[model samples]
Target chain A: MIWNERIECATRDEMRIIQSERLSETVKRIYHSVPYYRKKMQDAGLTPNDIEDIDDLRKLPFTTKIDLRDNYPFGLFTVPMSEIVRLHASSGTTGKPTVVGYTRKDIQMWAEVVTRSLCMAGVHRNDIVQIAYGYGLFTGGLGLHYGTENLGASVIPISGGNTTKQIQLMEDFGSSVLCCTPSYALNIAEVIKEMKVDISKLKLRVGIFGAEPWSEAMRKEIESKLKIKAIDIYGLSEIVGPGVSCECEEQCGMHINEDHFLPEVIDPETLEPVAPGEIGELVFSTITKEGLPLLRYRTRDLTRLHYEECACGRTLVRMEKCKGRSDDMLIIRGVNVFPSQIETVLLNMSEVEPHYLIIIDREGTLDTMSLMVEVQEQFFSDEIRKLQELRIKITKQLESVLGISVNVKLVEPKTIERTAGKAKRVIDNRSI
Target chain B: MLIKQLSVFLENKSGRLTEVSKILGDCGINMLAFSVADTSEFGILRLIVSDPERACKVLHDNDFSVNLTEVVCMNCPNEPGALAKALQILSDNQITIAYLYAFSTGDSANVVLKPDQLEECIKVLQEHKMELIEASTLYKI
Candidate 1:
C-alpha cells in the first residue's frame, strides 16, 4: 500500500543524494529571494555555495519561531503573492499569528506527502475519510482534505465540532476512516456511548489523529472506545502541515516524510544533533517547498527518530510519539497557547492582580483551562453582580487573546502558590 | 444614614466562614448583622460589626480580601408589612435597591439596604418618615 515505493523504500545513499540536491536548491533559492535568510547566512559567514549537500545542514543557521514572528505575514515567503495558492496560520506566542503560504507546486507536494501518509495507514481509494479537523486558517482540515482527495478517496469534509452530526455522517456516509485530534476522537466516543449509538454498526475502521500531542494510554483508550485502530499523526503548521509524518498499521512510530521534510533531533541546550534514537527537539527543513521554504527550522517539539526498518516495510525514518515540548507552550483543544499570553491579558486589567494560576485538566475527553486570579482590593465589591461582572470581563478578555474560553475563578489575594521567590504559573493535570 | 459594612471575599470552601468568624470573635468584635451572597465558585460575606475598623484590620492581617462599603440601615417595626412599607417609599421615588438584608431585635428589625443612589435613597426614605438608624447606634446594638 506504499504510495511511492521508489521514495519510501529508497536506499540510504539514494535518499541522501536526493536530499543533497533538494537542500542545495532550497538554500540557493532562499538566499537569493529572501533578505532575512540572506542576512542570516551572511551573519553566519556562510553562503549558498557553502551548502553543497545534506552534510552541510548543520553549518546553516537554525530558524526559530521568533524568526517567523519577526517576518510576520509575508516577509519570509520566497515566492510572490500570486504564486501562493493557499495560506494557513496558527497562533503565535503573542497577538499576531504565524503564517505559512503554499505555492501551486507546494500544495501538490503537500497532497502527495499526505497521500503517501494515508497509504501508510492502509487507506485506499475506496475508503471514505471523514475529516473532522477544523478548516480555515488551521492547517489540519484543509491539509488532510487535499491529501485525502489526492488519494482518490471519498472525503466527507466534516470539519471539527458538531459531534452528533459527525456520528450521523459516520453512519450515513459509511466513512471507514476518521481524521481529527485524538481528544476529539475521544469526545466523539463519549457522545456515541451517551447516545447509545451502536459502534459495531459503523463502518469506521481507522482513525488518523494529530495536531496535538497525545499519549500511548490515550491511544489505547480511543482505540478501545471507538472500536478502531487509532494511528498517531504528527505535524505542525510551520512545517508542511499534517502530511509531515504518520504512523503505519504496525503502530510502532510515525513515519517521517523524509523526502519532502528532512527530520533532525537536536539537543535543545547545545543545539547539536543528538545520538540516534535519543529524544531531542525535532527540526525540519522544507526541501521542496516553494512558497515558504524554510532551512533548518527549529520545531520545539521533543521526540527521537528511529532509523531501523519498520514492520510496515517503509524505509522512511520513524519518529516516536512526541514526549513534550522544549518550551512552555501548551496545546489546548488543538490551539497553541502560551502562559505569557495569559499573563499579558491579566497585566492589562486593573481589577485583578498580576498573580494568576492556570490549571489545565481533561474532563470527558475535552481540555478545560481554569484560571485562578486574585481580586484586587480596590475592585472588590460587596454586590454579587459586580463581582460576577468582573469575572465575566476577565474571562472575555482571556478568551479573546487565547482564542479559547477559560474558566476564571476570582480568588482572594495571595491565594495562588508561590515557591521561594518565583510564582508557579501553570498546573497541568492532564496525563498528556 | 450610611453604615460602614465590612465585605470579605471568601472562596466557597469548608472552614473559610468558620475561620473568618473565629478571627473576629477572638478579636472581641461583635457581628451585629451579616449576609452572605454566594455563587458556585466563591462567596462575599458582608458583616456589620461593633468594631468594623478593627474587624477589617484583623481580617486583612489574616490575608482575607476585606473592604469597607457604605450601606443604609433603617429601623422598622417587627410586623409583616413593615419592610414592604419602607421599600415602597424607595420604589415610589424610583430608587433602585441593589441588595437588602435584615436582623430582628426585641421589637423592631434592622434592615441593611444597598441602593443605587445612597444620598437620594436616604433623602427619599427620610421624607417618608422612615426611621434611619445612625452607624454608631446600629454598631452599639
Candidate 2:
C-alpha cells in the first residue's frame, strides 16, 4: 500500500516533477479517449502537448460534474468496459449517475490509498474494521472493504442499515474500527442507549465517518458515545471514494493523497484560485486515475488546502473541514443559508430535536422561511400558554442565530418523518 | 373516537401559530380543538380539525411534521368543576389520565382525553354510563 511517499513527503523539486508528469499523462489520456474531454480541450484551443507540466494545468480545460453527467455511463473511461473491473457512481438526486470505472490497477490503487488513509487514522493490521456504508455501486462500501483488507485487518462488511444487525455484528465480530456516516453513527449510539447494549463490551477503538458533511460538535458527540476517537473522511464518487483524503490521528485536517490527487481551492464565483488559507470550493485533479480520469474536477466541495506537515509522519496535503457544498447553499431573501448552519443552530438548542426542515417559499415576491421544530413532550407540562411562550422564544432564537427573521412552528414527538438515510432538511419551493 | 385534529409538529415561534392557521385557512381546514405541547425551542400543535386525514396531509406535505393519535372525546358543560366531575369519575375507578384538553362545540365544552389508564378510563366511562360517541355520530355532531 505504498502510495509514493516521496510525493507525499516530497522536497519541492520532487513534488513538482511528480505533478508535472501525472498532469501531462492525464491530459493525454482524456484527449485521446473521452470525446467530451476532447471537445472541451478543443474548445479551449488546447492539446495534450500544451499541458506539459503542473504549472501548465492552467492551459487545460477544467472538468466538472456536468461534463461527467452530460457524457454519462462510460463516457469518461480511458479504456473499454472489458478492461474495467468495477463501476461506481454518485447517488445524488437523479439523472444517469456520474459513473466511474476502475481498472484492476485502479482498484488496487484505491485499496492502497484507502489503506493509507486507515493507517493514517491509526488503524493497524490487528484491528477489526466494520464498514457500514452502502455497498452495490457506491464506492464507500467496497472501497473501504478492499482498503481494510489491504491493511491486513479483519473487515466485517456489515454494510449500511438494519441498525440492530449492525450492532449484532459489531458485538459478534468484536470490531475495533467503525466506519459510517456520522449521523448513522450517532443514531446507532442512541439505539445502544435505549437497548442498553454494553458499549463497554464492544471493542471499537476508532470510528471514521463521512459521506455527508457534519460539524465538530457532532464528531465529539460520536466520539464520546462510542468511547472511541472519531475522524472525518473526505472523498466523492467523481474523484475516488472515501479514501481520497482522511483525517489523521492529529485530527487537524484530512490529509489529501498528494501523489494520486492534486488539491486546489478556487473562488466558487470568480472561478479563480483562492489564496492558500482562504475557504473556497475544493478542486481535485486525478493525476494518476487510469480509468475515467478527471482533471481539475470541480468537487463543489467547500474546503481549504494546507501544505503543512501533519503531526503524523505523512507530508500529504491537508484539507480543512468542508463547510458545505457551494451548490447546497440556499438563497433565502438574498441571504445564503446552509442546512448545516441550521443543524448547527438546532443541535445547540436543547429545546429542539435534531429533526427539522427549512421550508422556503414565495410569499408574494418576497421569500418566507419557516423551521418546523419538534418540542420534547417532557419539557412542556402540556400547557398551552407556556407552549405559546416557547414558540415565541424559538422564533426569536432563530432570528438571532440565522440573522434572518424566521417563523418557528412547534411540533410534537416524532412528527417529522425520520430520514432513513440522509436527512432532507431543506425544501425550496420557490422553483415551483 | 373520530374527531377533528391538526397533528403538526412545530418549533415554537410567535407567528408560527399564525402561519399554520393561515395556510390551513387557505386550505379550508378549520382548527377546532387545538392544544400546543411546547419545549423551549419547538412545540407541537395538536388539533381536532373538521377533517382529520386531510388536515394531517396538508400540514405534513407542506413540510410541517404531523402525526395521528386517537383519543376519547366527551361533551361536558362550560360550567366550572365540570372537568373535575369527570376527573373524579375516572379517579374513583382508578383511571389515570395521561393528558387532556378542552374545546367548545357551540355552547357545550367538549373535553379531549388521552388517558394513561385506557382500560380503567373506558370502564369508568362505561360504568358512569357516559355516552360514548361513535365516530360517525361525533363527526355529524
User: Each model's DockQ?
Assistant: 0.79, 0.16
Determine the backbone clash count of candidate 2.
20
Clashing residue pair totals per candidate (backbone < 3 A):
0, 20
**lDDT of predicted model 1:** 0.92
Model 2: docking quality category: incorrect
Candidate 2 local lDDT, B23-62, one digit each (tens):
7888887666678776666556777776678876776566
Off by over 4 Å in 1: none
Tens digits of per-residue lDDT for model 1 on A1-432? 999999999888899999999999999999999999999999999999999999899999999888999999899999899999898988887777899999999899999999998999899999999999999999999999999999999999889999999999998889999999999999999999988999999999999999898988999999999999999888888888898999999999999999889998999999999998899999999999999998888888999999888888889999999888898999999989988888888878876678889999999789999999987678888989999998999999989888889999999887887789766889999988
> Tens digits of per-residue lDDT for model 2 on A1-432?
233465556765777788889889878887998787898889988888898888787666677866776776777788988999888765332223568889999998899889888987889899999988878777788989999998899988888878888888888889999998776787788877878899999999999888766678878888899899998888887798889999888899998887888888889899888987999998889988888788888888788887777767667878998876777656454233556666766767676667787888766334689887766543443335656766677777666655568887766556567878988888877632
Model 2 alpha-carbon miss at residue B130, Å? 36
